[model samples]
Target: MQALGPWLPDDPALPPVALAVSGGGDSLCLAWLARHWRKNLLAFVVDHGLRAESAQEARLTVQRLADMGVPARLLTLTTLTKGPGVAERARQARYAVLAQACREAGCLDLLLGHQADDQAETLQMRHQAGSGPEGLAGMAWMSALPDVRVVRPLLDVSRQALRNTLRGAGLAWVDDPSNQDMQAGRVRVRHSLREQDEREALWRAGLQAGAARMRRDDSRTMSFARQGTFRPEGWVCLGPVLPEPEDLSVLIRCVGGQIYPPAPAAVRRLQAAGQEATLAGVQLVRWRSGWVLVREAAAMDAYGPAYAGARWDGRFELFLPSSVSRESLQVGPAGFGLDRTVRGGWPARFCATLPALWRHGQRVGIPHLGWWAEEALQGAGFLFQPPVPATGGGVYGWPEARGAWFAAHHI
Candidate 1:
């Protein structure tokens, strides 16, 4: 429990916690700990449905938890499909299922049972992939998972100790056969670590190095950039001086609303262009003072008129409240095309992508810019709220690396 202290909420008045239990030794151990820690807890067994035995395994996991008086549910992943990178895709689908369940259940934090062996394997993989400090640091104890906080309280503990606890309690766990697959890099790495004399030392050094790397990452800040502006409308502009590689990757993701960063080669090309260019669905322009990045208007998908909840280019959330009949009203792009009369002073490229209200194919209003036709319909206005950052960390605005370093190195 002392090992779990650093990752838990400071408030002892605990909220109901959720755990992702896979019927495996590590996760089942977590189930036991969660039951001991909090009287109010929820456990989920994610059935990836990739194998014939998976469904039975989930049922058994639920029964075991029920025996312990801990209510558990089996969430099945139904959208799985056979394909290349099936394992990776299944992993993502599993997390998506878990995250959605947590949100619906109002559980802000979700616990996992990753331990020392998993940590070492992750670092080994990252090192082989030529990862930088951030990637080499391996997984953090706490990470932003869309809407839920993913907490790994057992990162510092060993897999052997967890299994020992289960053994002492007379608890049995399923051994997933995938763990022994020699073809998989992770399994191979795990086996190699077991035979290595320096395994313990390697794990310790990696954790210490990872901690140092995280401290450096947490200390990163926006202070170094000449100017940086992140708008509520999902556009950002950075200064004449380009951001560091790490910061630039995050910036691209934020403006593009993409989960993955632009390819390294693509980013390097953009940096060298120093002019108008587009990458990862984000447009980069050279403003007088510095550089500006915005979502590419041409790349946006068109939104036809709908009854309610109209979104523009997946960038803004739009809601139109009306008492009158909405059959005649339609929402579409504000065109700056030929013969179109658009109020000037704004970037023509950006204005074309703004949400426009129309009536019988006639332009009526440009909501975000506050433009309305002389005789516009009543009870009609534009209110758009961008979705909150799915993952909360030092990615956007100021980097937390500076703060992390200060806390670690200060007198």
Candidate 2:
């Protein structure tokens, strides 16, 4: 309680919180407790509207919240997708809406009611799939949700214990029938007697072991990464990576964060950037033997003169400097493959939109290629270059303002 005091401010300073009350036993207990401890908490009942009684349940939940003196915000979600995965899609949409609501309500914290049993089920599922500790970090106690933070305070308390608490307080609760249906994925893990004890034990043990290994590994990786960033201490964000069984294959974080060891293949593709290549979502600008991942220009920037690689009307061999060719591309043929079609290099966007200034291998004005790259171009390939209608627009030039020293070449 003492350790958690910093998070719990005095009444006047207490930040409002958005509670995701599903009318489940777990969340009910959490709302009940939070309502008592915090004064300005709001209850948000998100009805996925998947079942026949979902709306009615939402109504009952609103009434219950009102009775408890916590104002309720009702949200309903329309169905998306179909078949078995429909439920998960609904869940995602529900959270998306809830997250937006929390932000709109001027609240940074969103509370959830997941308990220990849910964590156990997750562990069992990962164990069955032969996942290592990386997969078993388990549910986070608190995590970022787009713009909101999801805090699960009832994970340590059991569902049975919560029911006892609710009943002890003369409160009635509605049970979600979907939880008991064998069709739900989580139900199988709970009922699996044959694999239950052993799987549970190994996974539980592995989860702890995995956490320890990650801490150790993270410390070591961070030290080496800091050395790499010694040149520009605060300019770049390079630190230890999150623990994973395999090398980091894909990433979405900004550059200032830790730079995990790129896959051997991605490293090679980056090295062999004779023209342009896409790894993960970033475009690699290859120089003699060095390359840097750059955000491709924005879709609205307009494509400049076509790169020599993209201009090849027929098959042509392009020579590379001796130093640059020394490194073999691990990504092989597929790694270099990006659609150069004028419609847009990446299937996701149009090429005319990508910033044209970066490829010239020249200095750029925008520091982060602001608005230059809406999304990274995909389908970039070395051997394959098909000419399509080109996006004609004003070409990008060196950063006139910074007047920084850069290569003699321009893209």
Measured by TM-score, the strongest candidate is 1
lDDT of 1 at 11: 40
Candidate 2 RMSD computed on C-alpha atoms after optimal superposition onto the true structure: 18.1
Residue-pair clashes per candidate: 10, 21
Give the per-residue lDDT digits (tens) of candidate 2, residues 1-411: 122222545344655777898887777777888878877888899888778898899889889888887888899887554577776677768776886687678777788887656666776776676554444555555554335556766544455677777877777777888777788777877777344345445435534654554464465456435432311111112232221213222221121121222344454444444445654434544433333333333311222333222212111112222332222111111112233542232332222222222333431211111222212322222231111100110011111222321221121
TM-score of each: 0.75, 0.59
lDDT of 1: 0.67
Residue 394 in model 2: lDDT: 9
Query: After TM-score superposition, what is the CA distance of residue 286 in candidate 1 from its true location, in Å?
Result: 2.4
Q: What is the C-alpha RMSD of each candidate to the true structure, in Å?
A: 6.8, 18.1
Off by over 4 Å in 2: 1-14, 193-210, 213-411
Question: Clash pairs of candidate 1?
Answer: 217-401, 218-400, 218-401, 219-400, 219-401, 219-402, 220-399, 220-401, 220-402, 221-399
Deviating ranges (above 4 Å) for candidate 1? 1-15, 196-202, 224-226, 259-269, 272-275, 296-411
